[model samples]
Target: MEIQNKSAGRLIKLIISGFCIGLIATIGACKKDNIKKEYPQGSNEQINTWILDSLSRYYYWAAELPKKPGLGQSPVAFFSSVKNASDRFSQLYLPNQAGVSSSRSLYGFDYAVIQEPLSLEVLGLVKCVLKGSPAERYGLKRGSYIRKINGKIFSSSNVVALDQELLTGRTIKLTLTELKDGGYIDQPELNMIAGLTFEQPVLHQVIERGGLKIGYVYIDGFSAGMASTLVSVFSGFKSAGVSELVIDLRYNSGGEVSEAAGLCAMVAPGLTYNTDFIIYKGNKNGGQRKESIGEAATFDKRLDFNALLQNNLSLSRVFILATGATASAAEVVINNLKPFMKVTVIGEKTVGKDEASFLISDQRIPKQVDWEMYPIIYKLFNAQGQGGYAGGISPDLELSEFTLLPLVPFGNANDALLSKALDQISAQKVNAGLRSSINEARSVSQIGRILSDSHLAKATQSIVLTHR
Candidate 1:
């Protein structure tokens, strides 16, 4: 992650669009005196008005908003009331205590606090850990349980506070645990702090089944630096002569559109300097932008046509493991590849985030004010002019990881999702009983955190403003 000391105008111009979900100005710095005298300092209505003004201008569904939301309501509540009833991705975040720029940092680990099947108490389950992160250094691997945070039990109500604490505080204490013999066993306590960590976008391992080499890659999320990491991963896969690929995007919330294009260029039919990838279309208020899977996709490491071909798997079909967490830039991969190859999506349906968002802040306001808005600004489509996955793209093979208790490691053959993908490749008979079990569990159980907390887990505070 690059630490950019950005001016308000320059920050607005560098908008990057992705899954987790930004303005321009050269204006005089806004002093406190610039605000109206009639409104008392820090009044809820005044803050709410600022949010409403920005939403009315840039929100994708601005026309649908209520004319005058309740003035007395809390600023956060008022902001919610004005939002389009259907748009779940648009969000508001209070800036870090230091200032707005620190909002771009992540918690290092994406965990889910779920209901313990036996006790029915909320328990945190690790989803994905960034490589070399404090969480990883503290030995927080996927499937490990979190019993407490700062010695306080985490329930649905206080989870948001936990998130805020992790994001803003200098240090945090985590009581890690695990499920053993139908009971929670305490592990070592960890005192950790947030730090800038560069995540390895691609995690890969090859498996040999029936004389075919299957390459498995787990993409945590797509950020600016992932294109080169992907190239290296695919290059290794090519050298090893893998015949099939399984991409695990169950936790990918989305990032940089360019990086999405780069990954698609590698797997899609055309690997060249200028291959059309996807179309960016917005509402009546905004114009459209066309982007290609070309040189623009990979910033630092631009491979020539032949070098791209050498790294290509050349397979007609691939398997993707997705959940509601698979969204935005991740969905771009699924949607863009459909036209050229066979994309078999396994696991649950994705987060229907066909629309992209922008990070918009009132340039007139100074950084001391902690409010920022991310509103849906455009809809995405493949080259074929096909999109409208607002409800999310369904999987071809419907299975959920919730069916497997004590969630198995990434490449485990018995893991329901991966096993099904491998079964398809090996031509083995589908396990009807396992499929039925997963289907049954779908109605009653869930893999990760409570439904209320899922949205918070997916909201990336980084601004991806595409235009001024």
Candidate 2:
């Protein structure tokens, strides 16, 4: 996952506070065909009026909205005033703020903070580095450990204070280290500044082990028009005779529903244009809407349905690698496919966000409003009518990457989650580490607590809709 910054405000705040695993909320992001080109300069009074009106019409919990929130309040605060207590992902962004935390602040790397059990020293484990980002330019990578930022070393004591400086600091200097054979060796310092950078969301690899060719796909996020990219990638996997599939959504940020539908179309077999994909049960004004697999896959004829059918893996089962960071769109695939095939999820449970939202900029052309509101719009459901996963989707096999320590990059057989999935596929007996429910209860169970914390872990997912 790239160092993308989501307007997922609270997740980062709490993660930075405790060195706990964090999740971010985001959406497919809505865009109007023509709105006011200029930013709005409306008074708080006018903004609050618009906010209340919009929420009433489209908010999933419109019935729960407060009847009277003083219009004098700031828009951000005002929006929060009416937001349902149950709503976690509904957010209001000031001008240039994240509708989905736009790419303006991305640094092209992602990290997980850990407090090593033995030394009690905190460490930043580089989980991923996007190609061409400053982090990659400085040789940062997965499994690399950050011992110091600027000149301050990490300790169990100082983690809370060091949080924002790492992400929002003007310039960051990192002291890198390698964990080798029970000790750490200091490496050359890496210096860089966070800059605007982006990458193709999908990363794929073909692994051949014991005469079984497995396709490993780590999807960072689902973006609009990703179906073609998925088609091309899966076509390659098909050509190479890849038989099994492992989809790594451990770091997946939230993304678009249609794009998710497209990905599902290519992976799950025996689905036609009318096959059910997602059901949007909206507020009274917005009503329940069902989206078909083909409608989302084709995206107005931008993609060929036959092309998706051609690239379909048609496997009996799929292994989904997930964590608390796996967003709603990814979870949609996991839940919706259950009726059709077996979905074996590895690693920790999911972030448990099932609702969908869209960007609500001023609807008018040459709009009067300067604000963007991402309101909770619908309760999501699948074909079998499974919904209400607000507690998060539990993993079939409970696993944690942090348990083994010194996180390995994706696709490495030594990687904890990948190794577990492979073991299941090959019918290998669970290793001592895996077999002992006692051990899983010890480390992984603890991670489950941290990942499900009300503050640290949030269901920060929303699907962008082109229409109401």
Candidate 3:
């Protein structure tokens, strides 16, 4: 009996030990799986490589080059002064491209007008005279292959280097391939001088239609000096007696917020406008304070509607042309102007991004890594107390399709959103004219009837001035 009991106990102990081992193995396997999923297989190494490469590029562009111009002070100052790190990096990556889009290459050559890739496909050229040297006439003709600038081959990898070399204003010798009698011929040693200038912001045109004069000003960006430029343009329109003005912000990715606000103030009616809704940060302890961000100096310079309306103008209506590219400061203009004026927003929805960010650098590490974190610093609301237009700004008049097939020119001048805005302004002008004529006639009749009454005449004049 004792031997049988011992055998049973031994069998139970063996079973329990086996179960414990299996459980531990299962747990270990799950932990391994979690670790694998968290970092993937080789993604951590790739991310580290990317970070290093980005830092290296930033150091080269922001640190090394600026020092030579007698402008840049220190590496720390360079990183701290950079407003938009990503944008600066993007410019370095595709030093030549005018703009960056998700579908296109990161960097490419831009004639400072349109963003385009460096390709065998040759487009048209500009015929502008080079500044400061009229005797040295230069023609940048289309279809000319930009073979090697300063004896270095042009490639995507070394495009930034090429850009840096060209920035020196040194004459570059190009080897071109000319199309001759349906055969390609190489032309060696074509000496061409390169001069760099800051990109311009003004796009102006006058469209006369339906016996009405309409003006179009497409502002692609609101950079420094934009406010002065806009003021000048609006003053011109005021002198020209333009019936209507179309402000096209279709591809405006936004810039200086102050400039945008200044532009809005020119047209906004009321003494004060709600540029953005202010938000306060709340803590678990129930403490709260107004959220502050960016360069403290620049924050106050942003648009204040009430201040803008203090200098009211005769401009009654404004046609705002927008698209997905209209964002940040552009959206601020749209939001602030909507309540006070006859704002006709005609385009696709805007890029809904209301919050701001600050750029931070960690110099404690050897890499001197710099990056930006865009926290929802503040929430913005229009006068009507609405926000979140991010999917895009819904067009007042939506078009069914944008692109037309090749060889099928299926669009009219009026079909464009800007053109449509012009039509609306023209119709409004006619209505306004009729109303003005009726008011004038009524005033004349009243004045004539009251001319004999001296006491009433003073009151009538007071009323006229006050109402007007």
After superposing candidate 3, which stretches have Cα over 4 Å from the reference?
Answer: 1-197, 205-213, 272-316, 360-376, 400-415, 427-468
Cα lDDT of candidate 2 equals: 0.73
Judged by whole-model lDDT over C-alpha atoms, candidate 1 comes out at: 0.70
lDDT of 1 by residue, 79-195 (tens): 888888777777687765344322124446776667754576677767667777777777877666787888888776787676566566667788987655556678777888777
Query: Which runs in model 2 stand beyond 4 Å of their true positions?
Result: 1-41, 97-106, 429-468
Residue 236, candidate 3: C-alpha displacement in angstroms: 1.9
Ranking by lDDT: 2, 1, 3
Q: Residue pairs in steric clash, candidate 1?
A: 15-465, 16-464, 19-254, 22-358, 22-359, 22-465
Q: Which candidate has the top score in TM-score?
A: 2
Clash pairs, model 2 backbone: 3-109, 25-460, 36-366, 36-367
The local distance difference test score of model 3 is: 0.44
Per-residue CA lDDT of model 2 for 431-454, tens digit only, reads 555333221122433332121111
lDDT of each model, Cα atoms only? 0.70, 0.73, 0.44
- Cα lDDT for residue 251, model 1? 71
